[model samples]
Target: MKADVIDAEHASRVTKVDSLLPEIPVLNADDVQLVGDPELITVSVGDSAGSGLATCRSVPEDSPRSSWQALTEHRLELKLAGPEPVAAISALLDQWEVHLANVARKSDIETAAVIARPSRDTIGSAELLQHGFAPVVGIAVRPAERLATTGPVTTPGVRIRPAELGDLPTAVHLQLELQRYDAQFGMTTMRAGAEEMVTEELRAQLSGEPTMWIAELYGQPLGMVRVQLPDQAFWISSCVNAARVGYLSSLAVAEPARSSGVGTALANHAHQVLEEAGAEVMLLHHALASPQSTPFWYAQGYRPLWTFWQRRPAVR
Candidate 1:
């Protein structure tokens, strides 16, 4: 007999399976087709160790119910599909788990949910501690728009300009200050020494790896932003079909400059530089749990495209 098939839509029926076997590996089976919708495909797990079947489904419209139901009393797995599959699967997994425990009186399986199309290599496992499903991180692509205003509005005595090799000392100081903030927020601090930071950043800048801008108030360096030229591979994959793109990395504003428009100024400069460099799109990553930075970036016109999920299975 042919293996069971699932589409992005019918994948909902397999929520029970997801709740039961959360850690089961999800393989992209783009080759198999489902019977109902030709646009959807069934992912096949051939002789897998897990004792369950999972499929993807598509939901054409926004409705409470969209032609998918769980099969109880059977070991199964399911994966949801949509523009935002991570969030949808998370909600469905929660409901399915609750219903199963309330009715079946048995709970032995570990269910896991992950956001597909992750931007990075691995979503650290720490993301699973506070929530059942890992939060889906977002990436935004900003379009180039002519600036109606002039350069950054700096403090009365503040200065802004491109960082030079001579600014390494000041840059290292600012980088360390940023590192302190990261440590306070339980983020991993860069183990590289100041010399390393300066060397790497300077090398990148000198080689035109990234456009670097610095903010100085009263002749004292305050903050920095680095706008990297678009990678050929990334451009071909994401925006090649549209327009040129760039990636913003290492945007930092000192604590004292938080509300002083320093961050916004640096970002605006980065955007301007990117636009002038023939980049029509820009992307950046932020920790979903980082309250201080997430909202700030959102206010600057970035939106969610994808998220990373993390979990650490108990070592045997």
Candidate 2:
């Protein structure tokens, strides 16, 4: 068989999942074809009722390699619309595993793996890894203005300047360090192949689309920030309301540089950049429970405009 594909529209039971979880979107089986066989079947449960779709694609049984490799190598995504959908989809995935095992055994295929997105309740890496999956990666947002006057005050040093290609590596390293600091609070870890990703991101920044700035002390990189102009629908919405917002995507201070005003200096620099770019406000997202940042942001004038919660089975 070229490939066994099952889509939302084709399966009655799949429709039931969509009905239960309207927020989730059904998968388009065609998109699954990008992965070559022996491929792991990608099953996505979206958070939508009639609006959402759940999809699954099975690899060819007679393929030369193991199915586990196929599943692990490709990106598999699953979204549960709500609490009810999460429970339902979890059960559904278990049922699919049984079905897959039977088919693999009959076709003389050994070593099959199925990876799904963890429910919001997913606890630790051990649990996710046990299920042959990784924890979901989440994006963190923080208001640019929050860092304005929060944290320890430091004497202003060098004036903020536009970042050059020569600063890309340093800026990238700063972002990675901040990410590492974030992982302490159960946030997504940026380790493992992150260096290459950061390098590519820096290259993109250098090419255009966003402006990057760095704050230096005594000729060394102390802190940095990046501001991207409004380009997407959400950004446009923010702008139409004259949100005049700037985003503080990445801000960091070396351990030795802390409490010396590096962060404040950087935020001040970002504010200037945003004002010049016509931004009257700035937006950022940070973990609610973060010790070093949450209070700092609060002190600077950024308040919680939204919240996100996650839960997973206590067992795994």
Candidate 3:
């Protein structure tokens, strides 16, 4: 098929599928480049032709991509413009496998992933699982209206305070701890010079819009949470329908403070801040397999909006 005809078909199908899910917005096509020798792969669903597109992205270790982006060095992203039959989706996935074989070594791709709305999970789950992908992380969201009905999480003697320039050391330490814990689940990585990078990032964030907060017990820091207001969060906010969205960038409680409600207190504080700032929804990413975070975030009123199904080491 000609590239223009295929592109037109792919756009129509994508729009059709996206309109079905009011909660998940369509991904920007500009961010993904078309790949494969023929570029567009197609399969038949009954009488109509269904199409799929593949895009590969590489994030250098020093790339400006943030840590929350799943720290994988390279990614093979597969997109099927479907309200089509699962069989057609599966065929496209098969083509992706062949494409993976072609570029896995040369690109040094680390992971192959499909970012799917939770409502569509059953659509291509069988093929995704058979292709060695696991639902590794969830992009969870909490609506702003829910915040008004929720009360503060009270943990006596635990107080949340805004972070200042002087708090950089403690902030960086807690941030790295969060990264280290998530790394074990393979959703995040602590790269070389991570500390320095984190230090600089936090230093700037502390001085700016997405405020950082420190949780204290007996006047000593025990936990921290970073929240990006709507402006700073716009990049991720595009994925949701809300007019104003905020992000819970990072949150961590020290080992000694775990289960002591320090984490809950910090989260509640972030909720109040975003709600007061007029954010219509809050979003965050949590490791799917983490014993602590998965339940913690859900308990805090967030629900999985999207699931990132990923296969590590892209080819094998």
Candidate 4:
């Protein structure tokens, strides 16, 4: 079935399943469809929707894009829900495996991912693991109201300031360093021309939004973070129930500054800035396996809202 044609009963059932995880907003069925037109599979029992899955295929190599798009050439994002979600997911994967082997070009599609909830981590464990998928990343959220009222938490001798066009070199270098580090974990890829793409992307953000911030320690730039306020965060704001949301796009600390409180200062500053800008909640993504980020974000009061289980080179 086409995503747009999902019936009300199915949508309602999906929402019911989602209610199990109150932290995540119930995505409207209409908005569940990904960028490319997606195909959906509906599991039914006696005329009632028992489960559903929607798959969207994405090909980022078709056009010039941001360096972040280097992760995969062809990708598949799966949206699933149901009462017996595990069984339904297993069946869907079974069918997809066949389709991948018979019709799809195995070498072209690089990743297949499912956006799931941390609350349901064990629900489909066997199925997801059997299919070679691993929980790789998490989308974490923090309430902005509390932070807004809280006093600033700054490290001594560290100063945070808005990034300017003149800081382009430092910003780009830090971002690329982050990309390269993350690439080691497979979530990010440093493709040919990635440096140019990252430079261009950072240049635009620096010159336009005034949303990025740099952390300085004794006059040396050591950390940077890009946060988009509610207005600028509309792209992902709808994913949560908060009427006003903020996004922590990227946060990086130089190797020399690791564990020196630079990251903490940068993040604390982001909370203060975003909250002051009227953000009711803030969200960010982090690689689940990252030793540096997991504990840091948790300490900042962020918890996983959605976990992405992914398998690279889909066919595998």
Candidate 5:
């Protein structure tokens, strides 16, 4: 089943969560598909009170995407367009939980995750928080011009250059260090074999899509930054299509290199590189729980554009 109306065409009962949002949350049931049993993914919106669609996908322990939410494996995507959206969506979520229980044991699915794409309005953001949705991941963006600037950490013996195949070992180590830092804030659990995962992911990223740049001080690899050209998948806000977006996938600085301005240097270098590539905007995601992330990104001219709220409930 799908939402009775597509694109919230007649969602009189629901109001826009963010008026400045580029597009309305019009994802119908057909908007997504799951990897598990087809029977596990069900939709229901036939004349439903809410104009929004509700869908759930159960993630197995081995799922690559499931690593972020260590305690919960259930993912939920929701958007209700109609009058009394909060109340309507609340009820729909309750029903979805029951649906999951019927098909799978509650133990396999502990939490519900939802990605709330960026928007200008606070209604949806606020409502989700009120309903136990905690802001775990944040999408931040800024223009390329604002990011282009004089080097912030230009000191004797500090250099930034493109990453090469030879830098994989240091690159992978830095990436793991970043994950460790984020884990301190509960951004993700330190799962077994995470190092192997990062090694594989970095090797592929270094070889393809993302352009990796390393920061060295006295020939010792202290940090690195990964940048990517705009890929539609990361741009959840359809309205953001007008400009070429350069994505900052990750930035890693060793503990010994933190205060020496290595991060800023890497950031400025990335800005210059992306600008040369004709990028108009820069985007990245961070966790709100990290004290270091909040101030650092803002200082670099990035502001919160979207929030991914999550919830975890015991077996129903």
Candidate 6:
């Protein structure tokens, strides 16, 4: 500031000076976002028809993810003819995390998950876990031919037989246990009126639609496992190539019968029964935690080709 005195010497005028502001760098879009060309496993990029059903979450439209190159969503697709699926593994995985986070944010999804099955070009199970996904369930497969070695071991006083229509009332009750067992592991949501819902479903399955096997200890219903030829693509299909797949859709043992080799016997019996009918492969899904399924299935020579990994996040 400068002051000038007039000849009258009674007043002074003051002049004020302003300083320039310092430069602040602004964030550009590239600087603020995830990597370019993220490998996205969505219906939008590749074959959108059958990416398979994601187990732990649903991907609705209007998700926050604005970028990605699509990957297979279902049924283990490996197409070498398309654009380069992955350029750099590390960069691609980083983008996977970003993609999951964005979808979680935008879709208001509680959990995000994906399925990894056998493929020549794929992020292997170990690598899949390394990128923040955890294996929650597994689909195990065994060739029907293997049943000869595991099967027909008759447990004294325990007989496995085909379920009759007369067994519907009791079997429906056991089916409730099956659904409750599934919900116990968070494999499925525990919906209201679930008992009523499953009662209706099991009734349909028992009415000649599925070959239900009931394990009995001298006419006592100890456990049950149902074997059916898959009518549709089960999302896992070395079995489909065999032209017939023996799918073990539901299995539940009574509280007193678990670990007594009843479930194992039933599985083997189911496998043997299916094999006789010319099924070339046997398949079943075991929740990693509930139904106490993992150890037993592995022991029965069923190795997992696909593992479902899930994690629940706070809703935004």
Candidate closest to the true structure, highest TM-score: 3
User: 95-208 in candidate 5: lDDT tens per residue?
Assistant: 655655664445443455454544443445565665556777777777777543663546677798889889999998988888888876656656678778777877887777
Per-residue lDDT tens digits for candidate 3, residues 1-316, read: 3445545655455445444223325553333333333355666555334465555554556643435443332343333443464766677777767866766653333444554535334567877788877887778888876526656757899988888899899998898898899978767767778888898888888777548889998788989999988877877776776788999988999999899889999999998888888898899988989999999998998887777777766766
Better of 3 and 6 by lDDT: 3
Q: What is the C-alpha local distance difference test score of each model?
A: 0.48, 0.47, 0.71, 0.67, 0.63, 0.51
Q: Candidate 2's error at 229, in angstroms?
A: 1.7
Q: Pick the candidate with the highest lDDT.
A: 3
**Over 4 Å off, model 6:** 1-89, 100-111, 119-127, 146-151, 230-241, 313-316
What tens digits encode model 2's per-residue C-alpha lDDT throughout 188-286?
Answer: 334446677677777788788547887788887877777665442133222112344456665777777877777777766665666556565566656
Q: All candidates' TM-scores?
A: 0.55, 0.51, 0.83, 0.82, 0.75, 0.64
Tens-place lDDT digits, model 4, residues 1-316? 3344334434454445443233334432332224444444445322222233444444354222323332232233334444565665576666666645643445553444444544335556678789887887777888875624655777988999999998889998998898888766655766677777778878888778678999999899989999888898887766666788889988999999998999988898888888888888899978788888889999998877667676666664
The ten-residue window of minimal lDDT in model 4 covers: 62-71
Model 4 stretches with alpha carbons more than 4 Å out: 1-37, 44-56, 62-66, 69-83, 108-122, 147-150
Ten-residue region with minimum lDDT total, candidate 5: 24-33
- Decoy 3 TM-score against native: 0.83
On lDDT, the stronger of 5 and 6 is 5
| RMSD (Å) of each candidate, 1 decimal | 13.8, 10.8, 4.1, 4.4, 5.1, 22.2
In candidate 4, position 212 carries an lDDT of: 94
| Candidate 1 Cα deviation (angstroms), residue 112 | 13
**Against the hidden true structure, what lDDT does model 4 obtain?**
0.67
User: What order do you get sorting by TM-score, best first?
Assistant: 3, 4, 5, 6, 1, 2
RMSD of 2: 10.8
Position 202, candidate 4: lDDT: 83
